[model samples]
Target chain A: MLNPPEHQVAGHDARLGGLGPLADGSGRFFKPLQSCSRGDNELSFYTSFSSDPRVPPSVRRRFFPSFHGTQLLPASDSSGPKPHLVLQDLTSQFTRPSIIDFKIGSRTWPPSSPSDYIDKCFKKDRETTSLTLGFRVSGLQIHESGDAYYKPSRDEIRSYGHDDVRRIVRRFVSDSGLASAVYGGSDGILAQLLELKSWFEDQTIYHFYSASVMVMYDKEGVENGRSGPAVKLVDFAHVVEGDGVIDHNFLGGLCSLIKFVSEVLTDPDGEGEGRRMKAKKGGTENGK
Target chain B: MLNPPEHQVAGHDARLGGLGPLADGSGRFFKPLQSCSRGDNELSFYTSFSSDPRVPPSVRRRFFPSFHGTQLLPASDSSGPKPHLVLQDLTSQFTRPSIIDFKIGSRTWPPSSPSDYIDKCFKKDRETTSLTLGFRVSGLQIHESGDAYYKPSRDEIRSYGHDDVRRIVRRFVSDSGLASAVYGGSDGILAQLLELKSWFEDQTIYHFYSASVMVMYDKEGVENGRSGPAVKLVDFAHVVEGDGVIDHNFLGGLCSLIKFVSEVLTDPDGEGEGRRMKAKKGGTENGK
Candidate 1:
């Protein structure tokens, strides 16, 4: 049988206690995005990359300055009622799903009793703003086994493929301007805070983990070196911690850091424009 | 944005894995019919309840004699060139998909090396089987998430639920009976001896794990409880040794066990017949 596997990737990395519920610690805390396994933590923070290949060197470099080693101060001067509402807007950009969980510090290992375990769990939860999130996302491109699983009979004209799905999602993101909106818009506040913490906590981690199940035919012509496309999801769960949990002062500061990072990542136009101009100048200079 | 999940459950576990090439190994391997947790590995086994409620007592007592640690030897005692085969026929008796794995020891944590990890994983897989086989099967229900992962979308409606899919497959198997005929109507046979040994030695340790996402809905007559008429597979993945290698012997043995288990699980007339009869009599006498 030419059954191929589909790929799927799912997990959530949320900030603990950061987005407390309006009433009773029940507010939804995280949003989720697709992921895969290509790094240390199976999830990664952005350094930089060029989406378009036509950008010129010097101009691109200026527009896309490296923030690889940059770190943001946890506490900020921005605070109070008039505190930057920009933080709220930026949170929406950090749209991966969030979960409420406690981190186990080394000191709490091997709790003395059940009550101790609960106490440890609760205390750790209170002191930790960075939470370990669990969310699963999987992708399947085809039904391969003949013995019977999810495969529709010959009558069902299913034509699912990973590339097709990716194209469709990406196309939708590009066409609807969601990426830009998320990058440039001021409504993703909750998301921004979570994203900021995730990146800050996992400075050394890169790449993401994902699984896919695809029929052989669906993967045709794609440069995927993998033999078959079978859908599967790899879950990435992690503990994220900040400089402090009780300090509300640093919230705005984290938001600002995220904004700076976001600008560099999403300013496709700025760097893209610079590169085009530089290429034109270079070409003319060479011609002379 | 009501992008209802891409898949839904089809109520019947055994009914899934019917997508053939489309349903191939992705969803099938990921579902461990016994439990839903990814961390806990459970064997793939099926359960069938009697239509007559009166027979509960007898059915409970002996319907599953195997539950009392019945040792299921290789299909036959023959020592000739014939290899053992466990063939199971698809039927309407089961509502869930079952697993067939192997175990040789207790679960050890934090495997020290690559080989240790593989050995532990294999033993855990086998242990699950041993436990399931020895205990009276409880919490035996179909997995709805298995159906959802495999369900077809409106844009791809040719996809049907697990029940409908199984019906088609059973019909196909009934009509063809080719695999059975090849073994002279015996349960699955060792297709080849060489393949079996190589299968065993060639086996790679895979940290196999699976979980199903169920869409639960309330049953019409049942209060407080829910009934899932549909199921779709949600997530599945594995970690194995040898880069991409697998032990052919273990796999072959597993396949045989699955086929055999399916046959016995579905066959009410098999060893479970006497117990079922007694249960019916007891229930009728007691007006239960």
Candidate 2:
């Protein structure tokens, strides 16, 4: 069963004051836009990017949600103000009300050298492959677990092969219940996944952080000849305005996440499924 | 020198994900109104208080700010919306923009039980007592020294003697350079202080937290004969609804602060000058 964490189970940073007031357990998916971890005010950056005139219409069209207006909100414990950006909520558009929050480039996932994985992903899933990959929210461990914490596992990063990628997509789809036919078979799914990854990669180049890559589909019993689900990026509090052509950190982190899932999905003797079950078994054995 | 810490110093409670974006270092004084620490959403409570029709117009006129309007702001970390109430910014009204942030009941000063001191302050300042108390940006310590934190001496929390109250006012006034005549004399300052204390006491009884009592006066060099400077309550993020009864915790805190300042100001040696010199001297020595 997809777990519904108590809505109040939100995360907070102690460097700031207690955020007890910010998280009221009401299942209202209102994510606040914060300054980037690097200390840039993301409201200004995200709002500008989402609606900035200088950005090409084509680039804007492929990604970026429709920009909602901005408003100043009271801080939790600070004597200052912050601004929040509104985007169209995906749940409102989906036929099935089920939603999951899959963070891109997050420390919660195994960390890897960022770009190596992205390049590998690009080679396999380019425009022709169109694969749709959905992530299991249950596997994304965001909470601090022991001393290891939820940060990216930077040291053990590696690129995954096609068999690996396919295996991972298989698990994600099982949870999603979306048929391979809906994805236009294997080739179509790869192409879609590649496109989704490319869009995400572009976001990284622009410096989006702690972003959520959401897959919103028709949850109805019959999607009736629909053209697959839609994936979009949201929660842009950590996005930065960059001067360099590429954000290597974003590339490396995104690559690491994509690569890890790919690894989790592969195994020739069906050992991939065995390994997946083992990991879950181990997690539960430790009383997690 | 007033030290400005990094504006990016954000508050966090991990029991809540990364508050990385919450603390941006803009010098804007925007404190968020939370559900009162008691669980009442203060934005609703304060705006309601500032605009409640049940309140007598006369009392409301004397107490609340002119109501502006309210708007829903994006939550920085959550998926739901929070409302922000806009009120007049006082800085716009003053010709010279020097402001101070004094917490109502604080740890920096000695602790006193709340009501006793409020009663003492009032009996003293009916008129002729003009005081201007701007809280120290830190605690009432008003000293820049070593890193010793402030806490009230709980055992000595009783109301101060009249001489003690007189003493504290003396030190505060000397800093202001106001004439004895302006205060209506030495006795006048104490009465005014008590009056000031009383006003703040009223605020706490009303269930305000993080409230500041500001003394606004004509900053111009000369006064053509104004009665006294004005002191109003600001910062209502923690304000709560009350049944017209005094909140003892708030009273105890406010009283303690007033009592401690009184103690800091005391000296029978007619060396009120020496007493003043001694307190400043003592503050520096303790490396406060």
Model 1 chain A: lowest-lDDT 10 consecutive positions: A82-91
lDDT of 2 by residue, B25-144 (tens): 332222333543422354566657776665556555543555555545444445455554445443344333222233443111112225564345423321111111111222121111
- For model 1 the local lDDT of residue A273 reads 29
**Candidate 1 per-residue C-alpha lDDT over B1-288 given as tens digits, one digit per residue, 9 for 90 to 100:** 111111223222323332111112222122212223311222112122123242244323321111111122221112212211111111112333221112211121212236665566535433342211111111112223443212233222222221222232232223223223221122222222122322333222232222221212122211222321211112222212221122221222233223333443254233343354345465332111
Q: Second chain only: TM-score per model? A: 0.25, 0.47
**Model 1 over residues A1-288: C-alpha lDDT tens digits?**
101111111122112222111111222111122223223221232222223243344323421222222222221212212111011111121112111111111112121125665466435422322111111112212322332223222222123221222232223223323444332333342243344333322221121111111111122212132221111112222222211111111221232223332433355434532454456566332111
lDDT of 1 at B180: 36
RMSD of each: 28.0, 28.4
Interface RMSD (Å) of model 1?
Answer: 23.2
* Full-model lDDT, candidate 2: 0.38
Model 2, residue A3: C-alpha shift (Å): 20
